[model samples]
Target: MRLLLATAAAAALFAAPALAQDPGHDMPMPAQPQPTSDMAGMSGMRSMMSAALGDYAINREASGTSWQPDASPHAGLHLMQGPWMVMVHATIDGVYDWQQGPRGGDKAFVSGMLMAMAKREVGDRGTVQLRAMLSPEPFMGKSGFPELLQTGETANGVTPLVDRQHPHDLFMELSGAYAYRLARQDSLFVYAGLPGEPAFGPPAFMHRLSIMDSPEAPITHHWLDSTHISMGVVTAGYIHRNWKLEVSRFRGREPDQHRFDIEAPKLDSTAARISWNPSANWALQASWADQKSPEQLEPDENIRRWSASAIYTVPFGHGGYWSTTAAWGRRTSAHGDLDGYALESAVRPNLDWTIFARAERVASDELALPPGAHGPAVTVGKVSVGAVRDFSLTPHWSFGVGGLYAINFVPGALRASYGRSEPQGAMGFVRFKLD
Candidate 1:
């Protein structure tokens, strides 16, 4: 907690002089030169946005070292101060959630996330980025909201949490990256964070365009991107043209029940990944990791995880796009191998309306078992669809209201435990975002 506060203080101090120069305005200025011919031809506002490593547009960089389609739209407040480019993205949701069945529960709670990032070019050939992401989920309480078939992490210090989504820590990420351009289309970089993401999964669900507006966490989270909030991470990678290869060493244990304090850091896990953006509309990746002990209650279990995913996006009407993602993941341990698959899509037909849907199936072993017990995995599936209507409140902010309905499928063996073969769940939420 102290470290997180100190980092934020230092960043404010670094940007103080620039902010003081123009006390009357809170908008971006063209504080740096355009590095490429393509960027030079863009409009002034577009050109002033930050240039990522290797002179790529910053919009391409997603959660951690992940990449998304270049044409994907970004919603944030962007500004340039002195030699630094700053971007802030945030969303808050007041939600009423209900899951129906014998094992289901209901809750009304609030959840939100805020991310701030700053970057600067170093002597023309290098770029440096510093990022901090915080969440108010801790205020949602430790047990978090109820979501049928969701698993992983613990709600208390001892027992594992099943069929419930755990709240994220107050400090979700505090990380830094440095990239040195080796050629026009190539770069080498290193990233390290006290609490950061490793290069082992697709962009975290919250960061993906396909499900960004939805209020529920995916059931396949553990199988796919559960490591998004590792305690310690160090990664090195090389990027060439549209392809990137990276490797990381990070802490494998999931965060403890405490959601407001920092945990000790360790680097006991290893992972490697390869990513490719074939064009402006496509992004793909494959990754593998040897996790030490990903579950706090199951300390002796070591699992090998593999994941592959592809995302596609295309522009349609003015300021609108359709995005889709197909992903598959698996984990192998002494108990057995469990697999998960997901398909998610979202469409913004216009600026005022956003629609999204997701389908997921996972082999879940924790659902029917007690907190500290292990059993054979059972197959469970969920399908959800929803929409949101947005109203612009100001130039830099927007308010939205949305609702979603989901149907969950469980196998015959577990039907009795869940009270039905198919359980239903739904959520209605009002949201506010910094645009």
Candidate 2:
């Protein structure tokens, strides 16, 4: 029954304070304040009821730490009363894939989430917010049928296959926002819902289009910053102090429809970002993106891209820390064309271990093949490595484990009928948290 109406809407949103403390109240009753460890203003009341139930409010703060580098025991919950706020998060994972088929079957996974936010506070500096969210559905495991395609076949291709099931990616989002507090470090934040879709770097875990924690498999290429399925995006940003600025615009259609012409004229994307921290350990970031795609039929073919990256962090001794990053990019298309470069590193010998590595090289062109198709249309090099650990076991809770490996050198019938060379893979995960 749709998992019993999503477990009775997550037990009536966590038993709504025991149904508002019922006891046949007649009046007098007000004394309940004491619970602080900073929950970021109750995570903005579940992002204002998930932007009034249209979804997409994905994180406005509710706790921090774990910005990936592999460390997940997961812990987050924020609750507030007055204007209203509520947030909940849960995660369970165990994935092991060594590739082969049945699309590499599966191994283990589980995930859950719930969110709500509502706000009003319209004095002094103004405020208005609304939001909502829910998630569940992800599972995998099935693969056995290749000994050279099961010899001459006689049935019993290792059994397993009764219509094979395991594929899910559920979603929901709603949003609305208005803010003003142009002081105390500055603020302006104007929002328009249908948000969720910000998975930069590492191509969001090498692009599988993220969604795991059992929302029914397909994880990596990072996509659950709370789900923003399509179109409509506008952001104007600034952060003073350590320096930060942003400009954004993302119109619509292109979340894996693989571009089949949605009447064209709606893939206009623009982005700009700048970050700086001149001293104290030094820091810097720069970004730019542009996607036109509207006029086609020849005439220079349209479709362009550009990229750049740089990072450096050093602390050493005592608590230990070290970092490095480098990146470069280019792209053009009528069908395909690309150029790439990358380098990465990480180290942290204390506070619960850490280590990382990366290398990359890419060259492509072959704008939609089929005239003779030989080698060298360009396609080469790739590599990866990973490790992470964190154990806080108390003061609330924590746990984690990680592993990763990837490779691609292209070859074999031009990387087996290339769809952008895909081979060599490895992964592992485990996490739990409560605070």
Candidate 3:
């Protein structure tokens, strides 16, 4: 039923929007009048977006309000109608996964995300933008798919999910923002969302150029980017040249097992982040947050999280680029402190092929214990490699197939439970996307 609803929603979203064109793949589309002004104006529609401040390309914007390397490549369908510029991005993956260990399980599931954005010039120095993001992850089941040593959220209201990646909420983001230019190189902006991301970690893994092609959740998700789906958030920021500083108030509680409904909003959490683009090829950020009871299972716990990340991208031939990301995150509370580290990279040799790899180490207390049990955090690691080959289906669509192999490292103390010190996992997937 959830899948059916998602399918209906998708049809409406895609069929009712303005005409779309392949913005990144060089697919042919009917010619349209191009914009003459640097800003969105009455000139006509174009297959592009612009920055809110300086008259620059819009590829710098990533998930939420985060920034990626300015030189990163974008894969989506874009159009401009009148004064409003619109963009649509979507990805769907059907995956078969297997984990080889006593604690492992296998499953076939579908995971997908859809996002749309519209922005226009409010006046000479102001810009207003609206965005909506949705997902069909509820169809993957409340417990989500198998991921070795991946832990967070709940499968049912009463049990903590361990060794699995829980499904995302049906609604990921519904937000709006307005920016006012303060000078030639400066702007002030405010954003508010009923369900949106705060100024937290790096752009969520699925939005990062380095890791977006892989259909697996990072073990470091909780320590770094789990807050990407907060129930409520409001942020204010200042951007000058290539630097940005922002602060947010948001709801800290993780979403419950019920994946189809919106929960009550609370602004009990606070965070601050600073971002910089040293050049077109490099984007960097550091952030801190004080979250009040971020876990539904641990309502009394308060955690302080810190994260730092750097992303680099270099474009080469037409529709080809190399991207890399290195990130570190730590969370501290009365229970203890845990840290996670990650590095990932991807290279698109050309329009048809992409190669990607990721390595991560995370400290987890959930892996060595059962539900409701307590134990010291154990550090575990994983490394994975994969590749995808895409075939263009139309001017705005592409299909691809890929597979990944991963090795998980377990500590000696927990080897008995897992059956091996090192367990292996693999996944094969097919993807469809608007390119």
Candidate 4:
């Protein structure tokens, strides 16, 4: 108990500063007129906004102009200057997360990502869009973020991180797309990028409205959306009203240890997804992917993955809402098949307080342990609950302090390494976000 308290105190120091704004989707910024001296940049931006948004004055989340029928809200910097409509999302999460059980400890770090996108109508024909995303983890460290039992990718970008959350690359994503509107509610588009995501899983957790309040990566990340950083990806999609069909071909190799450089592109993997937004308050998807060689250490292994998920959000009072997600996924490999499931949710009744919980069961590998500790496939279950107190430092940014405790259920074979039958972990963090 004392340790947890100390951890929380340290987290407070980490939040001394931070982002410009959150993605508040409903907030609208009045367009600034063309420039005069000090406003030159505003003029150019205005011109870009006019060309892209047309009469689409509101911001809606989804890929390109393929609107999510019931997209959740986000508060972001919306630049609607001229011919371009642009959106920028960024945040720096400073964590002092301390986990107790088997693979837990006083692990901490400050990591975040910045993503910017812009679109413009092309010659009265199609909509052209460009996106850039970056994170500074490459030069930061090799161990990446610490999360109990979290495994995938490599820590050094070479050896498997084993039980840690892999750091995102400095260039998380660099991509572009072109879309042609066929009707008021229909469009066809093509998107391509280096270090991009295929049409496989839900938007990566960081971007998901359901789990945005938590700092730790979901243990099921591997089975669900591990391909968020494919070396190369080309996606083609058709959107009709509240539904979208997408297919993609992408390089399957995980990024090598050299975080600063781009990996070789193989275009050896494929995936498809069907997304339905039955209403403006819910989103659903089913997806499948075949990755030829996603991990460097397991070059001979081919992975076939499938997943389905439902996300829902309902606005409440005073800038608050209820958001949740439940997802299931599976991976089939030569070794065997493993299933992963997660259900998480958060509710904020007001701006200052939030409550959240998560429960997950995932397949873990004993082989991921040191060579001598190798065993067979192991299944684990964990449940956690947490809350955060946000100090609204400003209208656009906020600092928060929160803690979570988790209970784990482990199989006997894994007991030797975990040290006990049931281990528990706890984390405390100072979270900062563009609010």
The model with the greatest TM-score is 3
TM-score of each: 0.90, 0.28, 0.91, 0.84
Estimate, for each residue in 1-435, the C-alpha lDDT of model 4 and write its tens digit.
233223323323332222222333332233433356567655454334332222232333443222322435544544432555555556776776665555656666776776666666676557776777777667557777656667777665346776567777787877777777787667787888887888987777777666767777888988888788788999898877767798999998877767788887779999999887787678888999998987777789899999998888877666677888898999998878889999998888887998888899998663346821335778888888888898977645688888878877778877777778777777777866653
Deviation from native of the Cα of residue 333 in model 2, angstroms: 6.0
Model 1, range 263-336, lDDT digits (tens) per residue? 89999999999999988789999999999998877789999999999999876765677999999999999889
Superposed by TM-score, candidate 4 places the C-alpha of residue 64 at a distance from the truth, in angstroms, of 8.8
Backbone clash numbers for all candidates listed: 0, 36, 0, 28
**Model 4: residues with Cα > 4 Å off, grouped in runs:** 1-71, 371-374
Q: Against the hidden true structure, what lDDT does model 2 obtain? A: 0.39
lDDT of candidate 3 over 1-435, digit per residue (tens): 233234434543563333433354232332333547655333443224466434445778898889998787655555555665566678999999999887889999988798877777886788887887889889888889888888888899888888788999999988888999888788999988879999999999989999899999999999989999999999999998899999999999989999998888899999999999999899999999999998888899989999999999988776788999999999998878899999999998898999999999988877866753558888899999999999988756789999999999989988988889999999999999875
Clashing pairs in 1: none
Q: lDDT of each structure?
A: 0.83, 0.39, 0.83, 0.69
Q: In candidate 3, which residue pairs get closer than 3 Å at backbone N, Cα or C atoms, i.e. clash?
A: none
Evaluated against the true structure, the overall lDDT of model 4 is 0.69
Per-residue lDDT over 139-172 for candidate 2, one digit per residue giving the tens place of the 0 to 100 score? 2212211110010101122322211222222333
TM-score for candidate 1: 0.90
| TM-score ranking, best first | 3, 1, 4, 2
